[model samples]
Target: MSTGKEELEVEEDFPVVDQDEVVEPPAEVAKTNLAKRRTIDALLAEKRLQKELEDYPYDL
Candidate 1:
């Protein structure tokens, strides 16, 4: 009974510690993400231009 209590106490004293790890993206994955980002940017720019054209005043 005393040994069991001691084991529990030891476990309580030392909690689990998490180790953070920095993972780097692979080259092919990085390239794919960059391509997707560029496509999204182009689409957004086109939408912005269309909005501006609609809002432009043609009363010159």
Candidate 2:
């Protein structure tokens, strides 16, 4: 008697990462990324404030 099951094969196109091999960015690059993020956040906050001001009723 044979088991009615077929083994499936899968091929991965990306490299496998090991938890031990994780690394952090260089200090300079990290600082640059942080600055960029802060700028983006400030712009978003300004946009939200502008929208709220537009929605506020000045006649009340």
Candidate 3:
């Protein structure tokens, strides 16, 4: 009995995995970060408009 060939089959019922369990983040923390990103985007858009108004040569 010296055979070393082993075959194993693995099957999962629930294929979906929760990413948070592997690298968890608090709910409030994630929400706050999303809010901050939105605020930053708004500020960037405002600055872009200001630059366009100043740089564009228009006869008024």
Error of 2 at 25 (Å): 13
Q: Among these predicted structures, which one has the highest lDDT? A: 2
Tens digit per residue, CA lDDT, model 3, 1-60: 647686667876877778775865656788899999999999999999999999998986
Which digits, one per residue and each the tens of the lDDT, describe model 1 over residues 29-55? 788989999999999999999999999
Please report how far candidate 1 places residue 21 from its true position, in Å: 27
Runs off by more than 4 Å, candidate 1: 1-28
Candidate 2 error regions (>4 Å) = 1-28
Q: List the residue pairs that clash in candidate 1.
A: none
- 15, model 3: CA deviation in Å? 42
In candidate 1 the C-alpha lDDT for residue 44 amounts to: 100
38: Cα error in model 3, Å = 0.5
RMSD of each: 8.9, 10.0, 9.7
Candidate 2, residue 32: lDDT: 90
Ranking by lDDT: 2, 3, 1
